[model samples]
Target: MTALVIIPTYDEAANLAWIVERVLAAQPQLHVLVADDGSPDGTGAIADALAAADDRVHVLHRVSKQGLGSAYRAGFAWGLERGYDTLLEMDADGSHRPEDLAQILAASATGADLVLGSRWVPGGGVVNWPWHRRLISRGGTLYARLLLGLDVKDATGGFRAFRRETLERLPLDQVASQGYCFQIDMTRRVAAAGMDVVEVPITFVERERGESKMSGAIVREALWRVTVWGAARLVPRRLRKGPRPEPESLASRPGA
Candidate 1:
């Protein structure tokens, strides 16, 4: 099946080259689209250089850092237009392993609409995180699952694969959350759509370079947004379609 990996970046120059090389090596057939939010540190230029070196690598340059949701939305639109059968969202900071892409693709081929790289599962774990950071992540996922009535163990995970049909069906424009909540909200919507979603255990390694973009403000935004989404769902039929388009044919392109 054709696959396209969408990686969003702000100022990830330090890790971009290695991440891109590893992903390409892992699945030579997989095409990559880098959505860079005009980084002052030259991330966009770096991505362009990579794209120039490899035909399978593509780059989308945004004017500024408009948040992760917007970047992914743009990338998804680009991939959809090209007729990619499967779309993968991953961090450019190297937290997600390139080796796991094959597993996610395999899961999608097995009838799963969405496959998440889960860290809370039995075979998954976090590396290089402080105790407090671990607590925050665990607590956040647990709270989100309970409040949103989701069965997913890692709703906040950024690493995920989606079938082309699933992305097309999801209402991408309606996605409101920005950071981590955006991930949770999308996963919950997928489950609500009666699509099969699965979690594949993955090792989430902390970024070794580049400054973390996470902050109190981003976390607060997630909390607020998730609360609103959860509350709105209480009305049952009030939920609108997600920000993604309906499933489209994958025959238009060779890779996702």
Candidate 2:
């Protein structure tokens, strides 16, 4: 099956090429899409150079920094238009290893609609993360799980693969959440649709180069959005408002 991995970037010039090459080397059927959000550090130029050198590599240049969800939405549209069968999401940073990509893809090939590269699963773990970071991740996952009724171990993990059909079925126009919330929102939608979701163990390593995109604002956004959505579920059917508008903003991927 054909697969396209979309890597969202803001100022990831230091780690872009290294991660792209490794992703390309991971699987013969894999293609790379670098969704650059007008990084002034010449990340867009670097992506252009890579795309020029390798046919499998492509670049999508946005006017300015958009949210993580926006980049994936654009990338998914591009891949869907080009007839890609499987679409994957990964960080531009080195944290989401290219080596584990094979396992995610393998899981997708085995009839799973959505496959998450999970750290909380049995064979998975993280490296170089401080205790606070670990706590936030675990806590966030548990919170989303309980509120959203999700059964997966790592609902907030960004390293994931989606069958093209699954994306087509999802309400892409309504997915406005960013960063951690984006991951959780997508998981909630897939589960609500009764899709086959699989979690595969992956070793997540914190990025060695470039600054992390995690922020207090991102965490705060996730907490409130999840609480709002969860509360909506408990509302009396007759008095409930319509569906909440999906969140949209300029943000980046943290470990969560």
Candidate 3:
């Protein structure tokens, strides 16, 4: 199977190279796509350098710091057009371990349409996260699960794999949420499509370098979007309207 792991970056120069190298070392079938937003930190240049040295490494340079969802969407489009059968999402901050990638991919290979690396599962946990952060994550996930009737544990988790066919079946153009909500949105989409999703336990380690992209705005956005979606879900399908098309100006585009 040809797998492409998409690592989204913004001002992550400190952690990018190390994470990319680890991911590449994990499996020979895996290739790296560094989707870098125009990080003034010169992360794009670093990605260019890595791509120059290794054929397995590729780069997608965005013009500005678009959110996490935009980066992944762009990466997915690029990988799909290149005929990659398997696409994966990972973080450049090292929170998502490369060592666990094999098990996730193996799960996907076993007829699962999507594989989620979950910290709330039986064998999964987080290292170095303080109580409040953990509470926020757990609470947010629980809220989403209760409201959305989601069965999975880590709907907000970012480490995951997708079959190209599964992605092709989903309405990718409708996804506009970013950060944690982006993960939740995809989970909802996959569940709605009756796709087989497997959650593998994975230990999430807090980033050792660089500032986290997490912000009050991101958390607020997740809460607001989930509430709106959940409310919409309560309406009967016959009564509910199809999603409104977002303006083209809001769409994300990569840099030349």
Q: Find the candidate with the highest TM-score and give its number.
A: 2
lDDT of 1 by residue, 1-256 (tens): 8899999999999999999999999999999999999999999999999999999999999998899988888999999999999999999989999988878888999989999999999999999988977877888888787677889888888999999899889999998678887888789889999999899999999999999888898788878877776777665553454456657778755685
**After superposition, candidate 3 runs with Cα above 4 Å error:** 237-256
Q: Clashes in each model (backbone N, CA, C under 3 Å)?
A: 16, 1, 0
Model 1 ranges off by over 4 Å: 235-256
RMSD score of candidate 2 (Å): 11.4
lDDT (C-alpha, whole model) for all candidates: 0.89, 0.92, 0.93
- Judging by TM-score, tell me the better candidate of 1 and 3: 3
Give per-residue CA lDDT, model 3, range 16-116, as digits (tens). 88998888888866899999999999999999999999999999999999999999999999999999999999999999999999899989889799999
Candidate 2 local lDDT, 1-256, one digit each (tens): 8899999999999999999999888775689999999999999999999999999999999999988989999999999999999999999999999999989989999989999999999999999999998998999989988888889999889999999999999999999899788999999999999999999999999999999999998899899999998888767665686667667544643543
Error of 3 at 114 (Å): 1.0
Record all residue pairs in model 2 with backbone atoms less than 3 Å apart, i.e. clashing. 176-247
Candidate 3, pairs of clashing residues: none
User: Once model 1 is optimally superposed onto the true structure by TM-score, how far is the C-alpha of residue 98 displaced, in angstroms?
Assistant: 0.6
Instruction: Kindly provide the TM-score of model 3 when superposed on the true structure, using C-alpha atoms.
Output: 0.92
